[model samples]
Structures are given as structure tokens and as C-alpha cells.
Target: MEQDVFRLHYEATQARVEEALREQIGRMGRYADLREAMEYSLMAGGKRIRPVLVLESCRMCGGDPETALPFACAVEMIHTYSLIHDDLPAMDDDELRRGRPTNHMVYGEATAILAGDGLLTAAFQALTQADLTAQQRVDAVACLSLAAGPEGMVGGQAMDMAGEGRSLTRSELEQLQSLKTGALIAAAAELGCIAAGGSPEQREAVRRYAQCLGRAFQVQDDILDVTSTDEELGKPTGSDREKEKNTFVSLLGLERSRELVEELTAQAVAALDGFSSRDFLVWLANTLAQRTK
Candidate 1:
């Protein structure tokens, strides 16, 4: 019965995210050919996990999904920007994403770079445009900026680049993954609390939950990169091995990585114990840990 409720919620959230993506993208006007490229890449399929996190966290905090929609859209824009930049020639240099040609491959390197920049800027613009109180807007901006800026996602990306082709300690690898993958996820949940005018204690609880879930999500992603097929993953597998990047599976072996994912997922779910209305978040954390791709 619990599983059924979770599945229903997940499906509903997925549909909502899909609808939001289409509506948001439709609002992007054609300034030039670049706009087309941006839309093409933005509409490329993803699991919409981050946006759903935003909505679920907001709802758990007694906020309306409608009130959280802008923040949800903002986080997705940031995530899309990261994917665009990650696939550039100077980065991962992937030719495919979400089972289609990557942004750079389809739109040229320069245009893809510009598209990433556009999405990054647009993310903050969307957050600022949210229909919320002045304080809520301020909190949202601060949380998101920290997540996307040098101290968070960008810093993690730099660390990842630096760590490539080099062995790292378990602590070092975990730290890098936490920043690169977890920061924005944590920010998304925190943004939800902020949007709802949640208390500091409630916000902290959400942040802790997101931090653990982010780690679990990234570890599962690394595991899938090794075990899942491209069709199952909607993207190429074995890219981590190809790139010679440090991942949990590489550092800890597959069995140990799987164990760590379970551990982290449990910790993530545990963090929600203080919240009375965290059914959706608890389900999300467990689902992320158990996801096939």
C-alpha cells in the first residue's frame, strides 16, 4: 500500500514536471537560431528528478506546488545548463545525451556554450520572478546562488577535472561527488522550504535530507553507468570508465558501492524523521537509491 502511494506520487510528479518543462520552454522567444538550439537541448528528455524534489519538498513543508513551480523550473534550468556544459568539447565531449545528439554536436560548440550560459542566467531570472514575498525571494536567490556558484557546483566541477586520471582517497572522492552532484540537489530542497516560509529548523531538516539523497543518487548513477544499458539509462553507459574519472564503483568496487548507496539512502530517509508530512520525500529518497538508471 505504501509503495503504491509512492508510485502514484512519483508518476504524478513526473507528469507535472513534463508539463512545466513544455510550458516554460514555450515562453522562450525566438531571438535567433540560438533560441532553437536552446529549446532543443532543454526539451531533451531527463528524469526531471530535481524539479520533483523541489515540488515534493515544498509540499512536505505545507507549501503549494503552484508556489514552488518557478523554483522547480529554475533548478531544472540550472541542471540543463550543467548538462550542456558537461557535454562540450572542453568537458566530457560526449556526442549523445538522453539518447540523442548532444547540444554541442547538434548546434556547434560555440552555440552550445552560449546556450549553457543562457540557461544559467535564466535560472536565476526565473527564481527572481517567482510570486513570493520579498524575504522568500531573497532566501531563494541566496540558496540557489550558493548551490550554482564557485563554492558549490562549479567548485565540484573543477575538482572533478583536477581529479581525472588520478587516484583519490575515499574521503576525497566522496567530498568531490557531494559538491558536484549534491549541492544543487540540497539547494533545491532548501529553496522549497524557503518558498514556504518554513522555519530554520525545518529548512535544516530538508537540507540534511537532500544532502544524503544527493550522495545516494550520484552513487547509484555511477553504478548504473557500469551495469545498465544505454536504452535503460537514456544515455551512454561506461562513460565514467571511458573518461577515467574517479567514481565510487571505481574506488570501492561494485559490491561496496551498492552497499554505500543503501547506507546513504537509509540515512537520507532517516533525516526526514523530524517532519510529520514527509511521505513524498521519504519515498523520493528511497526511489532514488533503488532506481535502475
Candidate 2:
């Protein structure tokens, strides 16, 4: 039963994301080359998990998924932008992403950089154009800005760069991962609340749930990097170890990290206890913790 819900949400959200990507890309008039490059990277395969979170959260709050689609796409664009930049030659220096050549590898460094920039700007544009109440728009914009801004994803990236090749306390590592990875996930949930006109208390509940899920998601990713193959992960595995980056799996044993993931998953599900529409969210949280990729 839970698997059915997961599969349904996953497939439905995937289709929505693809449609949004096509529509968004089509609007990029002129500068056709840059637009193509941007679309290439954006359309590159991903699980579309962030956008799905946005839609699911809105659905759980008794909102229309159609109304939430723009914000959902916006979050995905931001996530894709981060990935493009993260794979840059001066950054992670990754040669592959989503089982294909990195943006820089195919489009050149300058083009890749521009592609990332375009996607970031486009995300805000998409959010601003969402068909929502003025207040909802304002809140959604604020949530997205905070998640993508210096206090969140960018700050986290800075910390990650600083911590590379250095030892970090478990707390410090968690903090960095929370900001870098968890912020966007939390924003997904928060935007859903805004779109649904949820009360502050309800939004807070969803935020907490997403935060726990995001932490567990990142830790599981770390574990997969050590244990899964590149094909299975859709990117290079063991890259963290190769770069000597501190990860949960590096600081804690694999068994310990797995245990932590299960604990976090429980906390995430527990956060949704009072919500009336929680079945899909619960299933998503559990599936994320246990996924091979």
C-alpha cells in the first residue's frame, strides 16, 4: 500500500517536472545556445525529489497540485543550478552528473557557469509568476530566497569548501549538511504551506518534517557513495572519500550511519503524526531513507 502511494506520487511528480521544464525552457527566447545548454542540464535525469516534496506537502495541506506546480518547478531549478555549479571544474571537479557528462564537459566552463546563473534567475522568475495570492507569493519568494541565499545553500557550500581535507566535528558536519542540503528541502515544505494557505503552526510542522527528512536523505547519500556503484547512483561513487571530504559515513561507521538514517526517518514521520493527510509523506520519508540511490 505504501509502495503504491510512493510510486504514484513519484510518477505524477516526474511528469509534472518534465512538463514544467519544457514550458520554462521554451520561454527562453533568443540566446538560443545558452537556453539549449541550460535546458540540457535541467532536463538531465534526476529523481525530482525536491519538487515532489513541494507538491506532496501542498497536497497534504488540502491544496491543488496545479496551483503548487510553479513553486515546485522553481525549487527543482534551484536544485539543478546547485548541481551545475557543484560540478564545475573549480568546485567538485566532477566529470559526470546524472549518468552523463558534466555541464562544463559538454558546454564549456563559461557556458556552464552561465547556464547555472540562468537557472538560478529563472527559478525566482518562475516563483514570482506563480498563480497564487499576493501574500502567498510573497511568502514563497521569501522562503525560496532564504533557502538559496547566503544564510542557507550558499553558506553551506562555503562551509563545505572550507571543511574539505580537514577534520570536522560531527555537529559541525551536520550543521553544514543541514544548511547546504536541508534548507531547500525545508523550503519545499514551507512553500507548500504558503500555497495552501496553511496556518503558521501547520507550516512549522511540515518544516520540521522536511528538515528531518533532508538530514536523513543526505546521510543516506553519504552511505550510498561508499557502498553503491556509480551506475546505481547516477554519478561517481566514492568521490567523497577520494576528495577526503568529511561525511557521516566517514565519521561514523557504515552501520552507525544506517542506524542514524533510520532514527531520522522515524523523527521525520513522527513530525507528520497530527496531519490528517500523512500517508504519502510517511511513505516518502521511509523510501528516501532506504533507497539505493
Candidate 3:
């Protein structure tokens, strides 16, 4: 029953984010193909976890979740753009995403790159046009830039590429995942706190929560790639092993990776020690830890 309620809330949040994303894309004019490509990837179905974090964090911090809709949409856009690029031939070279052809696979590689660019720029555009205080917009943009920029996800990708075919220590692996996956997620939670006018201390607490949650998410992904079938993952599994990438499972073995996930989830939940209305976030962490098998 509790799981059902969490799913209901999660679905409701996902629906709200999708609606706003559609409305945001509708504002773009001309460049039919670009728009189509952008819409294709942007509308691709997923859990909308980042945007949900934004909304839920806002609510938990005593703000109107509705007012955070634009920021939430922007966060989702950034996340989608990253996924599109990550699937390109130059990156993970994936042909499928979210149970369908990847943007590059369908639209060709060049257009897929442009589509990613379009979504990235559109994220900032949405932020600039959102009904937010100037400071809020600035804070949100700064937060996202750090997460998505050279020192964050992109940097982590560079590190991952460099470290390929070579074994990595557990700390190195953790650092890579923190940047590659945890940065944007931490930004999502912090952006929510920013939207809610949360205190610096409160925002920092949520950031810690998101950072641990993000690391747990990647560890879980690593485990799933080894344990789950492609049909269950909606994309090719074992790509991690095929690519010889350093992962939690590769570094610490499957059982230890599972233990790490449990530890990370507990840390994430404990970070919200003082926040009211945090049961959903705690449940969300547990759900990710137990995503499959």
C-alpha cells in the first residue's frame, strides 16, 4: 500500500513535468526538423526523477511545487540532452534508449548532436523566461552549469573515457560517478531548494542527500547491467563489461556493490533527518536501491 502511494505520487509528478515540457517545446518556432528532433528526445519517456526531486524538494522546504514547474522542466531538458548525447556513436554508441531507437540511430548522428544542443540551450532559455526572481534564476543557472559543465558530468565522462580498459580504484570510481551521475542530481535537489527560498544550510543538506542518492543510482545501474537482461533494462545490458569500464561491480564485485548501494541509500535517507515531508524521498531512495532483483 505504501509502495502504491509512492508510485501514485511519482506518476503525478512525472505527468506534471511532461505537460510543462510539452508546453515549453511548443514555444519554439521555425526549424521544423530541429524542433522535431528536440521534441523526440525531450518527450522520450522515463521516470522524470530529476524533475521530481526538484518539485519534492520545493514542497519539503515549504514552497509551492507549482511555482517550481519551469525549473523542473528545465532540469528534465538538461537531463534528456545528456542522454541523447550519451547515446551517440562517439559516446556509449547506443542504438536504443527508453525502449526505442536512439536519437542518432533514427535522425543520424549529426542531427542528434544538434538536437542535444537545442535541448541544452532551451534549458537556459526556459530558465531565463521563467517567472522567478532574478536571484533565483541566477542561482539555478549557476548550480546547473557547475553540474553539467566541464568539471561535472562532462568531466566525469572525459575521465571515464580516459580510464577505459584500465582498472580503477574504488575511490576513483566513486569520484567519476559522483561527477558523471551525482552532479546533475545534486543540482536538481539544490535547484528545488533554491526555488523554495531555502536557507543555505537546508540547501546544503538536500545537496548531500542528492549526492548520495546519485552515487547509489549509478552503483545500482552498474549492478543491473551485470544482472538484468536488455529486455528488462530497456537498453543493452553488459555494455559496461563489454566496454571494460570500471564500475562498482568491476571494482568490488556484485555482492559488495549491493552493500554499497544499501549504505548510500541509508546515508541519503539520513541526510533528510530534519526535513518534514521527506518520506517520499526516503521511499524513492529505497526504491532505487531495490530497482530490480
Worst 10 residues of 1 by lDDT: 25-34
- lDDT by residue (167-262, candidate 3, tens digit) is 998899989988988999999999889999999988999999999999999999999999998899898889889899898998899999999999
Q: If the candidates were sorted by their TM-score against the true structure, best first, what order would they fall in?
A: 2, 3, 1
- Error in Å for residue 246 of model 1: 0.3
- Candidate 1 residues 69-164, lDDT tens each? 889988998999998998888888889888899988888998898888888887887887888997898889899989988999988999998888
Instruction: Report lDDT (CA) for all predictions.
Output: 0.87, 0.91, 0.90
Residue 53, candidate 3: Cα error in Å is 0.4
TM-score of each: 0.96, 0.98, 0.97
Cα lDDT tens digits for candidate 2, 167-188: 9999999999999999999999
The local lDDT score (0 to 100) that residue 38 gets in candidate 3 is 87
Ranking by lDDT: 2, 3, 1
- Number of clashes in model 1? 0
Deviation (Å) of 197 in candidate 2: 0.5
Runs with alpha carbons beyond 4 Å of true place in candidate 3: none
TM-score of 3: 0.97
Model 3: lDDT to the true structure: 0.90
